[model samples]
Target chain A: MSQTVKKTFRCHPEPDECKGCGRCVSACPKKLLKLGSALNIMGVPYAEYSGEGCVGCGACFYTCPEPGAITIYEITPEA
Target chain B: MAEVVKFGRPKGFFETFERRPGSIKKNMSYCPGCGHGVLHKLIAEAMADFGIQDKTTFISPVGCSVFAYYYFDCFGLQVPHGRSAAAATGLTRANPDSIVIGYQGDGDLAAIGFNAFMQAANRGENYCVFFVNNAIYGMTGGQMAPTSLLGQKTATSPYGRNALTEGYPLKISEMVSQLESPVYVERVALTTPANIMKARKAVRKAIQINMEKKGFAFVEVLSGCPVNLKMKPADMDKFIDENMTKYFPLGVYKDVTAEREPVVRPVPTFEKADVEKALYRELPGGDQEHESCDSEIFNRELRIKIGGFGGQGVLSLGLIMAAMGKYRNLNVSWLPSYGPEMRGGTANCAVIVNKGPIGSPIVDSNCDLLVVLNRPSLDKYLPELGENGVLMYDSSTIKEVPAVKPGQKAIALNTGDIAEEFGNLKCANAVMLGAIGAMLTKHYLTPADAAKFQETAEAAIAECFAGKDKIVKMNIEACKLGFDKMQAAL
Candidate 1:
């Protein structure tokens, strides 16, 4: 077996770009995505990341219809 | 911490949508949860992955996807409503190596452009079609479409779709699979992640077939219209899975890609000599020597308006004058306006002649010369004459000669009585042409050119009535008689 390593994945939501239809909320397996109460410049509440526990399955990236709305990334800790 | 991009915007799309014409260039104009955006993302990703972005041509239909060109970085053509398939055929044939894609909705493909789509599929054009069926018109309000489910309540079908009236939903995939030309046909949905994966694969396959030039490929995407259907995104997905899939029955209806070879259409030739030979079998004649008119009066543009009742040959008179200008190597344009009736209707034509390039053919006002064969035409067009313009009227038909402006000259000719004396009342237009010839020689043309005006008029008549020797001879004689009488009057 290989050594255990800390895993980190994150979902970055562009507030101004998201139309906030809540599609990504349902698409997230870890339930780490939600719509914020505060509206963006488009007058609709945009989706936000929970700031933790993002497995980065990319479900929310595909589910979010708007281009450039949800971008997923992987983070590596400094050695 | 080090960041590694997992999933971001595809490189197939422009870094910023500069063509969208709005402040938000990062987002598309589709409504929230619109299926077009999802499909666009899938296609854009596939384009970037396949490296066909440079050769791919997306034909956008006239529905919500009309602005599709504003998003994709590939070559895009926004065709008229329901004409994407037709345009795709031409694009694919003209450039056989191009990867052509047609994006259409239910109304655009099934309702309006169904035949065009089917004919292209039948001919096996090398392209891919992504048909988005949302059961209702998304752009033009939630009107029921050909693919709308039975008992579905829409804006047009308020009482719900009735089987007896609205007809059943069209099974486009089933119908397209029945054709022999299409190499691949599948129906997929975008409700769940698994289903969306299937749709994504289907999209890639369709585009791959197109890239390989393996004949026509069609994928009918059963999508949702959340806003139009007045449902939330989750409820819309449930509605599509529970209600739509039962009717649509998602699966591959046909796949003959393994048996078919890559399609190869003949490339079109564009050689100048070949094109000329194909368009015209034989050249008419060597260029005729054209004499240039050098009169000082001909230096400026001459706008002439001719008006008369139908059967009075008003348009023919304008044609003769324009022909006179053409034979002398001058710029000329003729615009004819008339009612539907061939007789007893108001007919008028505007003829413009200039030594230089002419601007507009419309002579609504400020005409340099006004010719009227009837009283009503005289009354209607007299006010349009310019300050120093000339007015020519047939006095035989127009008994009351209206007073002219101070700088204007009115030459009233009894051409109607002259034609009657010439034994043919139908020759009155020819007599009027002769009167115009006399007027031009007196005022506009130089003496040297004036002597050739009669020859020009005769040649114009012969060219107008090329094969009719009898009519041409009669008109020429009548023109001579009218010219002598008008010269005497002048």
Candidate 2:
């Protein structure tokens, strides 16, 4: 039952549109999103993704209220 | 895991509502990451899930929820502040097919609209009521709401909410749950992701109850006021989690869905014939509408003020004019001052007869005619009359008739004397109405006997005293006497 599943995702945190509400970081079930040290234009700490273990749940996208805050893309393994 | 897929915006939202020209998607009126946006999305999704989108009627009143009309893709009504619940009852009762969703704020539902909310809930209205409790009055600035937390500082409560002075905060969800009619009642929050999920469930269940036709359902969403609370967007949830939740506990207050039978809404078809049948209390065509005697006067747009003491039927006179306007099928409005001096105090109202829809009902300044029953009212209101305005005074009470400018008419009627002659001093205002009728129709003798104008006026007056035979006859006699005097003077 030990299978190494290599799945990746891209969490696009649109910097300009994000209100830095951190809803994305809190909603990510995979714990891949973290608040980066850098600040967006609004001077709030923007969320950054680790690009690992996204699981493609879209929880971050679902919970975000700010438009264009997060977009997730699923990665497929090469056959 | 399933592939992560996302749509641009909810299909239930109007594209224009979600965005403006050259703007990003989700151009909501609410602030960034406000609770309203999340709630709006939840409601829209519920409408879609239940297949009630086509039949949904979103009712939003004043407060932050006022802009909900622009958000919901379905039919929306922006009603008077705090009237969402009241209007929801009417809409659901009449249509029966539509799913009425009433969205209200704490200031609206708990404060000014509390009566309507209670009445609607007590009657087990067939609708879903969403009450957004942000603690503070968000739309009108961070003012104290009925649900504002104790020791919470707001614009009005600079020293924080003093429990002794402002009284204990109202537990409205618990209070509303005490009512015996509602089938479901729940309190939820929307600050965190887990809370948002719970709120989504609560929102869905509220709508689900309506879709089941299981009677009234209320969902109180403990939302945040980031801008008003002056908290950062992300920290508002933390603030609510720490401060607001301590006072307003989130839970299901009542759920009797399994015990109650589904509501059977009686849909009465509204047609001209149906209204006529109900109005006449008989078959349609049994009665005839009042035919116009003087089309010019009847059709003219006129603003008339009737002023006197409270008990003197100053308000009633304006109402009679409004009734006449209805008979003529002209749009009309009667706005009463409802001043403090009720019985002995000065009371007045403005009655506007218009060809089209009325704008503001307030008539503090301009008036085409001033009919004053007492000297005090006459003196106070005469100077404010518009140019070329007609002045009609009660000669029985007013000793001196004020001089009017050229091109203006002054009619003095001994209304008290005429009403006393008819064996009722209470009918003085009725007499004034008759004089006004005579002035307009140009007929004064036995105006009640005339089959056209005078009889029409009498019929309109009789409506005011529908059940009381004594008052109706006395008012008719008083009107005839006043009409004769005015006709003779002319």
Candidate 3:
């Protein structure tokens, strides 16, 4: 419904620690993250996300549960 | 877009998970990101939200559920493995106004306690059953459970379970739904945030229904066991999402509260008179019969010694004395001593009855009365009898009458022959008790004490052989024989 809205934020996921649990994939309100084929250093799958439609509301990060799995960061526009 | 991160742990949990040196209390026994931790938070939050903490009586069964008592800041009853629902059933019935929560794990509920859970649900018992079905046994090493997947490999099922031999996983929520009693039934998972929210609703609803006095409400939680699943914490959640969900679809299976009415069980009575009616049938009062003149002769505590061969009703005689004292509202105690060999060894018991509270129950040396049915008992306890103490023996078993001390009273009767006339040798012990009862009357005691024990002796004999009318009649007749024989000697 808000396709015309400008992009708001970015996501910071610790790739090495991600166990590819895909909790954010199910918890993401904007449907930006997915459990992709990319494997981390531990040989476990990991979730991938894009900044195009990312609102960075932190639902994905909040529901991740596993510590150090992912982090949410704001993408501020230039002043 | 300046995103602000605002999130914190649930309020019911402790501030920090760190354990300092020599910390006495541990927060919880849950693994990181485990479904049990989330479920515990959800349940505690729901309990707090409903304002039922004061009324909650949590029943935590074996397995990991046993650790729930450490988390909930409320009254809890830790039950044996597979008996959570049964204990909850009793608690809810006894205190209909209280909220009872039965918390169980898969091995506890679905497997070992399947019958108990099924009975509680089928009866539509008023309680909330929160069954956590985490595929495999978590507390013990990974083992095949009632809800284990067909191809799941566990410690017990080293090779993956085969449908041909191991059978399919039990669908408990679905099975419970078929019953018409439960007002609510639902199966929810803890795989994702959305599912967890749904699970929260189900858990809250079940407790809410229980608070409303509704019938049984069950919530089956499809949890994850990452340790046994051979996966990381998050991956286990994904396993539940990908595999467990397909086997156990999440949804509400029943909601019949609209058509159903609340059940109200009658509260029980607490009056002492009611207790009397239930137990002894009548409050004990001084009987008019057997009134004696010298009931006040003896004013001190009555310490009695009754001894005989084993299996000769020595314990029964002492028990009758204690029961009579107890029934008459007197403090009483019966301490028995018997040799190792049950049938042939000497057996004896001491009976102490006081009008007031008793201090020490032992009468090691000084005894007010002694009744010995055999020579060995007489030889063992004769010299121990205090001055003025009465000694009654069955002469049929003793060949000679021993010399009695000057102040003490001694009476011997053919008790075995009297019992033989009554058609049973077992009545011989009853005869000795009768003589002791007769001596306690005006013959040897203060008039008040004699009167206090008068009507009680026959009544005690009657109550001792209760429901065995024939034996009671014979024992009473044998007792009267011993009484008349001892009375003539005096």
The candidate that wins on TM-score is 1
Which of the CAPRI classes, incorrect, acceptable, medium or high, describes model 3?
incorrect
Pairs of residues clashing in candidate 1: none
RMSD list, candidates in order: 7.0, 7.6, 7.2
Q: Give residue B321's lDDT in candidate 2 (0 to 100).
A: 79
Q: TM-score (chain B) for model 1?
A: 0.74
TM of each candidate vs. truth = 0.70, 0.63, 0.67
Show pairs that collide, candidate 2: none
TM-score of chain A of 2: 0.75
Q: After superposition, how far is residue A70 of candidate 1 from its true place, in Å?
A: 7.1
> Mind giving the per-residue lDDT tens digits that candidate 1 earns over B269-316?
689888755643331231255455678778899999999999888998
Ranking by DockQ: 1, 2, 3
Query: What DockQ does predicted model 3 obtain?
Result: 0.18
| DockQ-better candidate, 1 vs 3 | 1
Error of 3 at B310 (Å): 8.3
Cα deviation of B80, candidate 2, in Å:
2.9
Q: Give model 2's docking category.
A: acceptable
Off by over 4 Å in 3: A1-22, A33-79, B1-29, B54-98, B110-126, B161-185, B192-198, B232-319, B332-352, B357-393, B398-412, B422-426, B442-444, B451-454, B464-474
Best candidate (score: DockQ) = 1
Off by over 4 Å in 2: A1-16, A35-46, A56-59, A71-79, B1-8, B15-22, B283-490
Residues B1-490 of candidate 3 have per-residue lDDT tens digits of 4554333234433343343233423335554445676677677767777878888988878986575766676678999889988898888888889999888888999888999999989988899988888889988978899889888899988888888888999999999999999999999887777787788889889998999988999999988777777886567877887888799888988889777789777766668888645643334654423223334432457888889999888988898888777656555778998989879789999988775556677766778888888999999999879898878888899878867899988877777887787688988887776777676663666656655554666788778888998887777787777777666765
